[model samples]
Each structure stands twice: as C-alpha cells, then as structure tokens.
Target: MASSSGLLPSEPRTLPSTGFQVVDASETIEEETLPGYHLGKYYPVRLGEIFDKRYRVVGKLGYGTTSTVWLAHDSVESRYVALKLYVANLNNTRELKAYECLDEADEKDHPGKTLIRKLLGSFQVDSHSSNGSSSHLCLVHEPLGPSLKEILDLMPPYSFHLGFLRPVLRNILIAVDFLHARAGIIHSDLQIANFICDVRSSDKAMFAKFENAEFTQPTPRKIISEEHIIYTSRRMSLSKALPLLCDFGETRLFSEAGTPGEDIMPNVYKAPEVIMHMEWDYKVDVWNVAMVVWHSLTGRPLFNGRSADGKIQDDRIHMAEMVALMGPPPLRFLERSTRMTRALWNEDGNWKNVAPIPDITLEKLGADINGYDKEGFFLFFRRMLRWLPEDRPTCEELVYDPWLMRELGLGLGR
Candidate 1:
C-alpha cells in the first residue's frame, strides 16, 4: 500500500507509535506526490537499504516533523549531498541541541555558511532485527533546488522585484540574523516548502537559454549540485522573489524556550501570538515573515479555508480568512494583543475565536487593488500584516523599507 515507489511490504512492517504507516487503502493514488510523499508524515526511506556503508542514500529528497531528506553520494566528498536525516527519538534532544548550536555558530560568527540545512554528518543504525540497537540519526546537506513549491509549479507569473527581492531577502536576512544573533535560534518553521535551489545554476541557464525546451528538462547528470534548479530559476527569474525562509523543525532557543503558547506554525503559519496564548518572541518570526510575504504577493492565502470534506481545510479557517482580508482585528489590535485579548476573541468580544470569516476583502487581498502599478506592494502588505506583534516590522525594519528603497534604487542602509 505504500508504493509511489516508497516500497514496504514483504510482511513484518510494524511502524506506528506515531512513526506513521497507515495509507494502504488498497493503492491507486496519484496527484504529483513525491517530495516527502505523506501518509501520516513519510514512511519510506529506502535508497537501496540506505545505500551500503559510507553515505549514499540518494533518494527521499524531502520531509519534515523533525527531519528526513536524502540525495546522498558523499563517500568523503565525491560530492552530491543533501542528507538531513535526524529523527531517531530521544524525543529529539532539544532539536539536536539547537542543531548543534547552529553548526557551532557557523564556525564562529558567520561570513558565509549557515543559511540552514548544512549539517553533513551524523550516524547510528541498528534495530530492525538481529537484537536491539537503535540510533539511526543523520544530517549532511547542501543539495539544493526544487521547492519554492517546486518553483511555483514551473513558473509563468510575475510582478514585484526589488532586484530579485534583494538577494532573496538577503539570504533570509542572513539566515534570520544568524539564527537570532548567532545561534540563539527561533525559526519556528518559515514557509515556501522550506526553500532550496541551485541545481547547477538551473542547468547553466537551461543550457544557455531554452535549449530544446519544454520547460528545460536536462537531467542526465554529472554536476547539477541541487538547489532544486537554482530555486527554479529563481522563481522563473523573479516572480517577485521572497521565499527563502526555511525549516528549522519548529525551531526555538532564545534561551530554553518553546511553549510560548504552543501551535508553533503551519496552522496557517501560526503566530497570532502563537494562536492566542501569547508570550512569544522574535516577534513570532515577524508574523511568519508577514504570512510568507502575503503568500508571495497573493497567489492567495492571506488566509483561506474550505474543508468539511472540502478536503481538510480549517487552519483556524485560514486565520479567519486572514482577518477578513486584513481589517477587523484592530480595537487597538484587540487591546494590545494579550494573545488576541485574553486567549483568542472570547469573553463576549466574540469572533467565536476567529472562525471561518473570509467572505473576502481588501479588494480580495490584491493583484489589482485599484489597477496595480504595485502601490508599494499594498504598502508592504499593510506594514507586514500588523496584528500587534509589536506592530510588526523589524528584520531590521524590514531591511530598510521605503518601499524597499524605492524598489531597489539604493539607499538600503541597514
């Protein structure tokens, strides 16, 4: 039942206890699922039984909920990495000690190195029989490309471009300011399917400009160091490039943290002060980088919801459909957001805790709110979707915004 080429059946399977393994409804299911296929959260890791010996696994290519990526081949740097494994259980020793103190603070105070996803070593195997052993941890990355939601499903859209979103938001604000000032950490899951890209400069710019195209194929290999085709040709040459916020498995560490009102994100990029319990910090990663730059300039999702067999919706009904498209939540942002006024819109202030509100508004989250000439991108999405994370803005004042220095004209002083 687990076969989208993730094989698993020769009898004797037994995974559950939450390691997941229940999607066998008699096979036949397809809808472009691969990049961490999913059932309960991935249950397949077989690149020829973990490719015998000194690192080689080369396959799984993506996953989360405490890690699982692969595309190995590094018999000591013969190159072709992107490992990421980690999820062996000891209940993830404080996220593997904050990913080994952000890889030793990127070998002591970065100057390049530490844009997250670059571990490159960890091993321990045994316990699938022949009497107990268990410790299978792993992480050895740097295989980029294919995930900007697979390059916005192979591009064909455009607008917004502060010179390619200022070098992908200056490499996600230098990896979130080196994980909040050199490894204090706080990623708490940034979106865009955890960004990655480079596949050898997307096949030398698709072999120097569309060589025999059909959306540039070319994968015969021999040097295409993944970055998922250089971030799918940087979102097909900047479709308002923004995504780069990566996955640090619900990250945290501004000194022994977590439980700053749970629901850590992905519940529609959480953060209404961690869904109304408040006490959060790193401004809940600047309101999840303003709801992933308003779903990369509105491909839509300033909040959405649909299920009831409408196919699994309800992330607080897409944050009450993004507070009815960015409007009602201000009563001075519900009295200075004590996690949205005493734990989410209750006590007769109703909103039935921000239900499925969106009938739609803000000229429908934009894309021509009064004929788009990009009016400072909806005033930088209303100053980064402010709902009182101390009135948002601050990734160094959204990297000096003046509409991002008059759309990259310069003057971008820190």
Candidate 2:
C-alpha cells in the first residue's frame, strides 16, 4: 500500500532522445527528472530473479539520490512489495562501512530496525553497463508515500489535517528519539521532504466506504481506484506507531567521540551549533524535528532560503532569515563561534555569516503562514529556531510539550 500526499494522475512525461547528450543539458534534465543520468527503462534484474523467484517487478514506483524503487508482486505471499536498488556509486568503502555498521547495530541494538527503513533483504545483481565489471546490490522495503515536501508542493497552500498532523508528529518525534537516544545515530537530513507516508490494508476499507458513496453498491473497478487513493492519502499516520526516520544517507553515529559539522546537511534545517562547528549532539536532531513539526502544521518550511544552489552564501542567507525571526544568538554562544561566524556577525548582533532575509519573506507574503490555529505551534517554531543551539529544546522536552500533548490526547497515555 503506497500512501501519497499530493499526486495527480497524468500521462508520464517522455524525454526526447539526443544522439549525443551534452553534459550541461543532461545535468539539468537529470536533476529535474531523475537524480542521475542512468534511468534504465528496463534493468537486468526483474521480479522473477530475486527473493528466491517469488517476486515480480510490476513498475517503477519512485526514485531517489542513490536508489530506484519498483512496485513488485510476491507470488508466494500474494502481496505487493517495494524493491529498492542501491546505485552502483554507493558500493564504495565509505558507504559500505556505514551499511555494515547499521546492519550490525540493527541486529544487536534495534533487532527489528523498526523505526528506520527496514532492510527487507539485500543481494547482489549483475550490472549491464558498457563496462560491466561490477554488479548492483539492492534492498527491499514496503512502499512509502510521496515525500512531505512533494505533497506540500502539489497541494494549494499546502496543509495537513489535524487528524494527520498529530500522529505524524508523534511518529517522527519517536523515530528521532530512537535514532538519537537509542541507536546513537543522528538523521542529519531531517525535513518534511524526507518523511514518507507508510500506507497499508486499512486504506482499502476507507476507500470502499468512499467509493460506495456514489452508488448503493459500487463496481469493483471503482472500489479498487478509491482504495488506491485512500491508501495514498493515509498510509503512514503517526497513529501507526512505526519508526520511519529515513534518508540515512546523511546519518552518522555520534557517541562520546564527537559529531560531524554543518557540511553534512542541507542548509535549511541545519542547527546553528553545526553552522558554527561547535560541540553538537542530539539537540540538533531536536531542532530538525521542530522544523518538521512546523512544516506539518503550516504547509510551508520555516527556513526556506533563495539559495537553491546550496552555496555557503545560501547558508548565510538561511541563517540570517532564522536570526530575523528567532532573534540574535546569545553573546555567550557567539563568543564560542568559529572565526567564520565571528567575521560574519552584523551590527544588530545577529551573525553576519548570513545576509539579510531575502525579499521572499514568509510572514509578509503569507507564503508559510498557514495552520497557525493549533496552540503553541508558533511557540514551538520560536523555540526550535533559537540562534544558539543550547537554547533549543531537547527531544525529551519536545515529546512532552503542552501543545503536542494536548493535540495528541496523550494526557495519561491511555
């Protein structure tokens, strides 16, 4: 069951084949369509070859930076499953080390590895490149919904229902807590864009009811379509209680040893301590959770900057915007910043590492200003976006927040 936020059905967009594609043009097209230039129309391994020949690849479901997901049917199990194949580039020592570490930890610490993307199974498959020296390795998982970012983009003035919001936030928080508090990992890339709705059988029932609205008894075809739609809409609710902290491509193990710096993450959700290269920890994940919750409540990202180029200037622009909304970093915090930020501090006591917030102001333009009705949503935003990392709430505090408690109806954990 695949749960999607905002997908409108349309004819698949076809690309014109160029005899010799230029690097620049190919780069642009690849970025917009596929993450890489190699989008195989048909690959070497289909459903029949893997999982002891029980699964059959039906069609492509989704794509990502390092993998392509295909919807598959398990013949023996009589069910649909998702097959995620890792890109060949990830077969190197760096990624291999991380994968080995995660696999070992999952068996020992997590056992089921329930919160993050479950590694259904992994196997090596033959490659079909011009130079087929190496084979591809793929992992299997249940299908997930369109990312929160994609969902928001498709919706008009993007918004999530309270029914959806409360549970989703709960799930995200718990997942983060597990990653930081339990697994000793930090999901460096924590954002609405990374959250996927995990839909399953219950959606079929909801769709049945919805389809039956038009007729005393709806046709099988109509019911099936409705079921698919409902499945897409509500698969991975926070109520499901699944740990779905995904995009571990940026994840890092932060023991007493130390943590990686801002260089590892996208500029938007990065913590100030990371920007300043200070001793950071789980609180950074908390900051990211706050940003995700804010996006969930309001359909807009709290710290979106104009620098899509992912440059240091863009980071600066993002930081300045954050400072404007949340206030300047504390003097003590600033005193500890690296020379980069020290040289960047502005007259307003805000770090000059960032420029003035761009003309694209969320409040002034009402771009990211929706869904403010829930109590303390703004307060949550204010707290999370504190210029000083120490000023931010811990994951434990956020889990027990009044706003979260009231909205989630977890007064006594009944």
Winning candidate number (lDDT): 2
After superposition, candidate 1 runs with Cα above 4 Å error: 1-71, 74-81, 90-124, 127-133, 137-142, 145-161, 166-188, 191-193, 200-260, 263-270, 278-286, 291-329, 332-375, 388-414
TM-score of each: 0.30, 0.69
Model 1's number of clashes is 14
**What lDDT, from 0 to 1, does candidate 2 have?**
0.54
Please name the candidate that would achieve the greatest TM-score relative to the true structure. Answer: 2
Model 1 deviation from native, Cα RMSD in Å: 21.1
Tens-place lDDT per residue, model 2, 291-395, is: 676676577666766565654345567667766665666777766655656666854566544466554433453344444343355555566666666677766
Candidates in order have lDDT scores of: 0.52, 0.54
lDDT of 1 by residue, 230-331 (tens): 111112222232344455656878875545457676766776656655567777787777666556544444664666576775556655766776655766
Model 2, position 185, has a per-residue lDDT of 74
